[model samples]
Target: MLPQELDGVTLLVDVPLAGLQAGDVGTIVAITRADDGRLRYTIEIERPEGGTADGQLIDLDASQFGLD
Candidate 1:
């Protein structure tokens, strides 16, 4: 299900992997809706230590996160 504000929504990661915990927060940078009715989001996961050195831009399905 899509969030009320769509793009730029803050999300809480629901699944843990690759050193990321379940509650990691990310900010959506872009959104795409496919012709087949699938939604994809681009999010920026900033390093908690406050630097861009290890930050990541990840693309995830809508189910990957929850609105914060």
Candidate 2:
């Protein structure tokens, strides 16, 4: 399992949240388990060029991301 605040890259297209594409670098803000007891992540991706002002925080399952 990944640790909190670890940096990583997205591995899936999270269309609902700012259209996060594959390879977008992000940081794991928090780690929590889903209703099914599966691990989930709250990732904060600082918008490139736009910086944190246009960044996004999204929740995703473990399979949707990887260590950077």
Candidate 3:
């Protein structure tokens, strides 16, 4: 079901991926609506040393994740 209210919101995401540390710069590449009507966000993380890593945001809820 869709969220009852749509409003301004912010979320704090913490990813515990291997070799991922703090201070990494990343940009959101795409935001797509899933089959179940949920939104999926794709982020590209740029390592300071010299490489880039891609990740996906999953299993998010509108209420809990502050997404509307």
Q: What residue pairs are clashing in model 2?
A: none
* Full-model lDDT for every candidate: 0.62, 0.71, 0.43
Error of 1 at 30 (Å): 0.4
Off by over 4 Å in 1: 4-19, 34-36, 50-54
lDDT of 1 by residue, 31-50 (tens): 77877788777777655686
Error of 2 at 57 (Å): 0.5
| CA RMSD, predictions in order | 3.8, 2.7, 7.3
lDDT of 2 by residue, 42-65 (tens): 888756777543457888876777
TM-score of 3: 0.41
Ranked by TM-score, top first: 2, 1, 3
Which stretches of model 3 miss by more than 4 angstroms?
1-12, 17-23, 51-68
Q: Give the count of colliding residue pairs in each prediction.
A: 0, 0, 0
Query: Under the 3 Å rule for N, CA and C atoms, how many clashes does model 2 have?
Result: 0
